[model samples]
Target: MVFVVFIVAAIITFAAATKLSTYADALSRLSGLGSLLIGTFLLAVATALPEVTTTVTAVFLDNPDMAVGNILGSNHFNLLILAVFDIIYRKRKMLAHIYKQQRYTALFGVFMTLVIALAIFMRLDIPILTIGIDALIIVALYLLSLWIIQRTPVPEQEKNHSSQEEEYSLKHALMGFIIMAIIIFISGTALTLSGDQIALITGLGSSFVGSFLIAGSTSLPEVVTVLTAMRLNNENLAAASIYGSNLFNMLLLVVCDLIYRGPILQSISLSHAVTAIFLLINSSLVCYAMFARKNRRFYTWPSLVMILFYILTMVWLYYSS
Candidate 1:
């Protein structure tokens, strides 16, 4: 029964994700919000709906580790997706072309990593007030990002693309967006329940299951969007979606803490700590790659380095925890 539920949940999740992506793309066009902004804030949050819902549910049931593990595990899996994207889009080197906007996106990622790391290492008690404060900060950052983007002039080539694309009808897109959101919510709830059941049956602990299996399951939307975008030669959107998702995941930690209604920092398990550290390292490397002068274009070496680093991190996490 548990396995059956898992399969059902997976199917629902995949279908909803595809629909959500379509809605998000359409909405971005209608809103006149550049793909970078939409990808980073709007679409990223929509795609992370599963993680948000699952973690909140886990915390409500007093399974804090599951909540922490889901986010950390999701982060690790997200990096793996990057490697996959590189392999699938071998000729284009998607990361290189998107590095221009990625600079800010990567910085936001660094900020998020730092916040999570501090919460983990310092063992800070995140009170409701702190969560509220973090939420406000996220809102402010999002608004600031928009203002910056609005002020920054688009290049002639980018402007041409923007102008040439067919304008999306707001009413139609909104209807699709609403329907997709409902599906996402329902599927996310079912997936969370299935994940809980699997953890109980396997006796592997909910933290492990949530961090690895459940986290990977929820990140499928991101993987699909990136791979499909790459195939379509939408390199910019692909990169935007990947990095955007990371930023969204980071911010969701604050939301999770708020929903958990306690000091989430103190509730995190040791395994979660390991995952957080790995995320920090991964984000750092990405930041370095973006800023590095020579080899600005993502070469084979950095990609290989990232893959090896990811493997080692996972191995260490498995052994240490």
Candidate 2:
């Protein structure tokens, strides 16, 4: 029964995500926001609604481990999106042609993941009005990342699409984005419940369920958006969407912390540090590959290592936790 519900919810989420990506792209072009900005802020946030909704639900249920795991897990799962893209891309390496903003965005992701890991390790008991210092820092740093990325100019070639006459009205696009978001919220909430049930029935633990199962399920929109962007031959948007979605996933933890009474970071199983460490490693590798322009034959080496690391971390989490 749980499996059936999970599958149904996943299907709905995917269908909603397909439409959401279309409207998000239209909104970006029509609103004069450009793909990078819109991908980072608008599209990214919309796609991340699943993670946001799922994490909020977990926290409200007093499952901080699952809440934090979903964020960290989602961050790493997003990196794996690059690996999938690499496998399908027949052209040269995917990351080699990405814009400079994407490179910087990956760097910022690594830095923020590191900050989160440190907080978990330190397990600070102190909280100002029930919010940990780390939670505040994560939120502040996320805003700074957005500001920097927005200010960093995208290549003129990339702006060509935005200059053309819009295909959809601002009202239509906004409405589409909203309607799809609501669908995602409902499906995502269902996914969270099913994930918890699966974890309980199988003894996989919330950390494992959140990091691998829930995170991957919530990230379905990202998969669709990336594939769509790549098919359109819009590599920049594809790359930007991944990094941007990751940024929003990190912020979901802040929402969890605010809702989870007490220091959310310190309260969850420190075993989560395992997932966080893997996240830092994966994000750093992505930054290196992007900056170095390493385009290996078949697929990028960094992406291969990324998949391997994620699998190993999952194994470690399963047994150790």
Least accurate 10 contiguous residues by lDDT in model 1: 153-162
Give all TM-scores, in the order shown. Answer: 0.87, 0.94
lDDT, candidate 1, 1-321, per-residue tens = 878887887778777667566656656556666566666666666677778788788877788888878877787787778766775666676666663765777777777777677767777643446564444555556556556655654344444455555545778777876776667667777778889888888787766787777888888877776765565556666667777777666666676766775667677676676677777777777667556625655465555666776677566555544
Tens-digit lDDT string for candidate 2 (92-201)? 57788777777767887888898899998988666776787877887888889888877877567766777667767899999988999889888999999988899889
TM-score of 1: 0.87
The residue ranges of model 2 lying beyond 4 angstroms of the native Cα positions read 163-167, 294-299
Q: Which candidate has the top score in lDDT?
A: 2
lDDT of model 1 at position 151: 65
- For model 2 the local lDDT of residue 152 reads 76
Measured with C-alpha atoms, the lDDT of residue 89 in candidate 1 is 62
